[model samples]
Target chain A: MDIIVCVKQVPDTTDVKIDPKTGTLIREGVPSIVNPDDKHAIEEALRLKEKHGGKVTVLSMGPPQAGDALREASAMGADDMILLCDRAFAGADTWATSYTLGEAAKKIGYDLIICGREAIDGDTAQIGPQMAEHLELPQITYVRKVDVDNGKIICERALEDGYERVEANLPALLTVISDVNKPRYPSVRGIVEAYQEKEITTWTAADIQADEKCIGLDGSPTSVKKSFAPEPKGEGEILEGTTNEVCKQLVAKLMDKNVVR
Target chain B: MEFALNKEQEMIRKTAREFAENEIGPIAAEIDETTEFPKDTVKKLGELGFMGMTVPKEYGGAGMDDVSYAIAVEEISRVCASHGVTMSVNNSLVCWPLQKYGTEEQKQKYLIPLANGEKLGCFGLTEPNAGTDAGSQTTVARKEGDKYIINGSKVFITNASQSQTAIIFAMTDKSKGTRGISTFVVDTDTPGFSIGTIEQKMGIRGSVQAELVFENMEIPQENLLGKEGRGFGLAMATLDGGRIGIASQALGIAQAAYEESVKYAKEREQFGKPIAKFQAIQWFIADMATEIDAARLMVYKAAFDKWQGKPYTVSAAMAKFFASDIAMNATRNAIQIHGGYGYTKEYPVERFYRDAKITEIYEGTTEVQKMVIAGNLLK
Candidate 1:
């Protein structure tokens, strides 16, 4: 089995600050880290590779700096790291990103595909299902538990209150949640090997034979008109009077506002 | 001369910091209060290839450079000095010597398990009478046909009770003084070997320190490390590397203290303003930050020298003394900056203060470090 995991490098949101005057993110000095949920995806892929003997390959699409993210996944025991880096892939929305990744997946061939439920920066949660549709493979999103045997993948997709069990055939895709598994720290040897011994394969738009019309900003349809931090909520009013009296007053106010019958 | 860490070292620092903050930080206080050994976390560290960072991979170790090892020790110590010393003793004191001097058979038998973290090891050199004057060792080993009879007691031995293997020094020829000493690897389970008294300590309590007594302990001749009468040189050489680790540990302690002081000064209020608004507190923070950075550079220089196969005895000594001094001073100021809360266990500054003291005392004292540095200059 050969598993391909898609990862992204994003600004560490914890340290990111918004400019109060301009309403734009200050990203100059912010450190970049692999998307947190994608770490779970990499960890799950490695676990699957361990239980069933196979190779685990990690792939990403971004600038050259994203190679660091791929190197990190390699340190976590991924067999190979590939970065789809090209200026032509710039300004890709979820659709263009999915198309580019799906094209690469078609070239690499995979027994299974794994992706995070969503990237923290974008929070679109569309890439995995979109890629699945492009590749015409079955996909299970919000997967919390997975079992594989006899070319069939069984997964527990987390729901609002519970989880739903779903099974799919081979050549499937999974978008894992943070609860899927805890990621392991890279061993000292792993870090050394990742940097010294392994080479990250870089593919461009032409290498994956991506469609020129669907590979960059030209293919992306969504556009942001405005972005700003949400307004801070105001303090709530405290009800006055005795318990019964306050309750009656609350009910009357709620009724008057059509908040209650 | 590059000031920045390379990609590999940066990754090591990141991994260690994450591990320290997420896995060890929550339990640090609990372990200190209980004085119980942190066995589970130590085992986890072993799984991460931290127990023997510089040992070769073929020998079941991580095979990392000395700089990477230093960064790891610093990160771990930043959160818990007890774990820091545990890792330091295993890597610098035990596995290092075994890898450098042990014969293939010895490496096969002992080094493999110790390096792999399947077993733990401790160094046994400090004695009741021998502290800084390590040449005053009194333990005796007498040849008895195919075996040697050992008798003596060691004090302040780290990981004494829990260690599966011990690299001990004993007087094989009393007339030769320090030259008579020989190094031997002894299984802690030998018939006459026993843990005597566990010490109650003021700092790094989460790591055990105890007395070891060897009463008529018998061992085969094959356990000897290097050649007879060469133990003193081997021990001294080992301490040179060990000092680098201690220096990194001290740097970590000081860094933690400085960070705490900065955080506390900004939030603590007095006289209608945050204490950070005061010039006096600002000076302390500035001095701490400056010294901590200096100590880190010294440690890195020592580690880099060792990695490059350059002579590093003086550099290591200089780093150890300077870094440890900063650790002590920084932690003291950290407590002062926190006012009454710093002196109490409500904050970790008090714990850092206690842990900082041991860095100056262990491996070699500050005075001994200066002696090594000055002695080289005079010569």
Candidate 2:
């Protein structure tokens, strides 16, 4: 079996200070890391490899520095690592990112494609399905439990209420959540070996045979017209009285808001 | 014991868990197997202010309390021990010293870069002859006019090869023993300063560890840390803080191991039933969970003490010793639960077992920790 995991490098939000004057994210001192959810996707791929004995390849698209995330995936346990980086790929929304990643995945044929439910930066939860649509592959989203056997893939997906058990044939895509498995810590020897090894492969837009029209900002369908922080809720009114009076006031407020029938 | 974490601590814990699970966990084993350093990951950690968790905001650090630092270390280690150590060394050993003893200019120049992750920093004290006995180091420095010429080498220094700056300890007055020692901040770019061979380590290999050789290395007088002859105290103080970080790392490793074991036991079948249904397997999980909880409490207590500006040396030592021991035990049991598969490279528990052993040996050996705790109690 061959598994491909898509990962992304994103600026850690806590470190991302907004420039008030420009209303833009301050990228100067902020460090870009592998998007937290994407890691679950990588782990799921590794898990599939462990159970079915297959090759695990990790693919990511970002700046030249995003190669670090690929190298990191390699260090963890990825059999093959690729960085899909190019200047043309800049300023991409989720649509463009999925398109680029989908094209790259198509180039690297796989029995299964895995990704995190969403990237932390965007939180759109659109990339997995978009990539699936682009690749024209069946997709399983919000996977909590996965079982691979005899070329058949079974997954339990978290839904609004409980969970949904789904089955798909080989060559499908899976977007995972954190509860799937706890990731292993890199050992000292793993660190040393990852440092010494040169397994990360870099690819540009031309390398993946992607059309110029469907590659970056031009290819993207969605664009953020404007971004703003959520408005703060009004302060609560204080009711100073005996316990019964306070309870009555709270009940009245709840009724006024239709929270209590 | 209350299992509930406060809002802020819980938020930090959740964020760290999500980051570690998503970012570091998948690649941790590969980095360990190949000994690769995740430079980008380190930079990301710096942006999160993890590299300077305890340093004040003015110094380009996170300005977080010590408990938050411990939480961060535990969460990171839970996914990748190498990154955990790298984070620990940066936040506690390198960045902490500068924040505490550095002059305003020193803070602006060295601490800023180190804290921001633009530059990596290392702490140097151990020599070939000095591991546990760091005060017996042979590295020396001689004052000449406006500069101090340093000679000799430091061994087994974490982040030495990659660090832009190193807070190094050297003896200035040989006759005064520990009192003669002084600390200096040396730039790795100095003509006479060079990194030696990287050591082939058993675990935590993602972090750079090598010998730092200083041959007639010239440092400006302003680079001297604190007052002359205060190096011993400074080093001790630094280690006190470092112990908590190591303890947190141990807690993370233990948690990872225990969690893996639990999952495996529930899934793997033997004797017509999942091993988790067996008494023996159930007992092991119970022990692992109990010990991990205890270790977490100890580590958090030490971090809390430090955050409160109280003396935490004894608590830190105890935490380090106990947590590291628990890590080793948890990893061993996790492998045992996997049976034969656990011993192979195919299983991560074996690697966790191997990696967990070093936590007891470094950052003040478990034996040394006992001595420290006992000695402090006696005093």
Output the number of the TM-score-best candidate.
1
Worst 10 residues of 1 chain B by lDDT: B111-120
Per-residue lDDT of model 1, residues B8-80, tens digit only: 9999999999999999999999999999999999998988899998899989898899999999999999999
Question: Could you tell me the TM-score of candidate 1?
Answer: 0.96
Taken in order, the candidates have interface RMSDs of 0.7, 12.4
lDDT of 2 by residue, A1-261 (tens): 899999888888977887777677788978767787777777878877887788989899987778767756665678788888898887787878888998888888899999988887778889899899988889999999999877789999999899999999888989999999876433222322344555567788899888888878887777889987555479978998999999999999999999998
Write candidate 1's Cα lDDT for A1-261 as tens digits. 899999999999989898888888899999899999999999999999999989999999998889889989988899999999998999888999999999999888899999999998888999999999999999999999999989999999999999999999999999999999999988888888899999999999999988889988987887677888877589898999999999999999999999998
Q: Each candidate: what lDDT?
A: 0.94, 0.85
lDDT of 2 by residue, B36-85 (tens): 77888887777666787667667877566688789989999988889999
Off by over 4 Å in 1: A232-261
- Please provide TM-scores, in order, for all candidate models, with all chains considered together: 0.96, 0.61
